[model samples]
Target: MTEDFQEIVETFEFLDDWEDRYRHVIDMGKTMPPLDETLRVPATKVDGCASQVWIVPHIEGNGPEAVFTFQGESDAMIVRGLIAILSALFNNVTVQQVVDTDAAAAFAQLGLDQHLSAQRSNGLRAMIVRIQSLAQNKLASDS
Candidate 1:
């Protein structure tokens, strides 16, 4: 796991209850800067989510070795927090690392895997897919 995400895990361990964890997640979202409105176009928009969602990829250097990150947003506060969590999981990693990470297992460590509603879970999976697809595309292009 990325150090950023490990911090979240450690925080979750400190929190006493699910409510507190949820609050922490929401708080994380609250701090995320809103994505620029102009970038919320169709191309960046993620489908299959019940709430509106967008992720704009930011890559540094070039090719498969590039460091990958993104700025993301969602209409729902909880979803936005989820995006922040994903950022912790993915940000600053190589495009190859982003593609290789087991996001499901990482989220499982947070205990969100069991707590999220089916719809939210689906939405999360959709977001992961979008992220992985972007990394895969980058890798392919570089090759």
Candidate 2:
């Protein structure tokens, strides 16, 4: 999964400009499998996003080896793209791995902060926090 993430980052690096990168991000969002509408309820909606966003987390097993799965959606294309990147990065990772992952670093690696609007960046941080909170809850439950 890390290798896959690295590949995505490298791919993003190949794009020439922010406009092209935004298009690539939108394309990534388009590739995401349709998320279940029922999962898009208020409880799942991530707060502070500039657009509507939903996140559903599923944890399997216990400890460092526990698998964490996430399904998410966002109304805005760029926001959806951010979710797609997060889904690719965190999905199927262990609970510990999810908790340990530095989402801000990942965004920095992708040059997100430099290119995105402040509102979009805030939304991105909200998304990361929501996912990390889910992982933390799973860890707490396991203990």
Candidate 3:
């Protein structure tokens, strides 16, 4: 659904090593528009991130079929890039899609699992958990 996501996959597939991939990710983060200051709040802050990360969900449509989008930011460049990847995958999609997505598998298919440090891996997993939780919460509220 995201053009950049496809581009990213293609680009990563082209790159031979993790070095270039890391740079691409950092570059993606550098280009990401800054998050609104007001959106960063205690309630929105994701726990277990190595950096200060905030995620907010926006929804459209109605009832159980409503679609959701996420906006997020992080103090760390790597973390921000991680957020971008998640956004690319989950943004502007149905809550059920978010719940069904195999985020870890997607990352692994990109060879990110082997490249990520323990802290980064944990942070990434936390982000996925948070996103899924948001979807689940919306489903509950919409019921």
Candidate 4:
């Protein structure tokens, strides 16, 4: 998962210009795993995305070290890549880590805002909101 982020950063670094970067971003999107159809429900759908998106989060075990798993899908390839990037970072993290982590900062560290379109940036925010909300809910339930 960390490797994925490194690869993204490397790809971003390799591009000489925005046009090349856009193509690289699209290539990154192509690598995202396909979303499961059965999980696409209104409750799972992430709002604020230009395309249809669904996210499912599952917490296993207890305490601050417990693992959180996530599965997601999006109609747009770029969005799917965004989901993939997020899942790689957030999945398997503890609930406390999820709550404490700054997703936007991580994206910034990867230069996502500079490389992605405004719509894609909004979609990424929507995805982060959904993941964070799920983590918060799980923590509440666990408490």
- Choose the strongest candidate by lDDT: 1
- The sequence of per-residue lDDT tens digits that candidate 2 reaches over residues 1-143 is 47767878999889878888889889999998878887889999999997999998988898778999888898888888888899888998899999999988887888887988899989999998999898888888778
Off by over 4 Å in 1: none
**After best superposition, candidate 2 residue 139: deviation in angstroms?**
0.6
The candidates, ranked best first by lDDT, are: 1, 2, 3, 4
- Cα lDDT over the full model 3: 0.87
TM-score of each: 0.98, 0.95, 0.94, 0.84
Best candidate, TM-score = 1
lDDT of each: 0.95, 0.88, 0.87, 0.78
Candidate 1: tens digits of C-alpha lDDT, residues 14-46: 997999999999999999999999999999999
Which tens-of-lDDT digit does each residue in 1-143 have in candidate 4?
A: 35556676677678768677666656666776776777898988999999999998888987666688888888887677777778767887788888787888878866777777788788888888889888888788777
Off by over 4 Å in 3: 1-4
- What candidate 2 gets wrong by more than 4 Å, as runs, is none
Per-prediction RMSD in angstroms?
A: 0.7, 1.1, 1.4, 2.1
Clashing pairs in 2: none
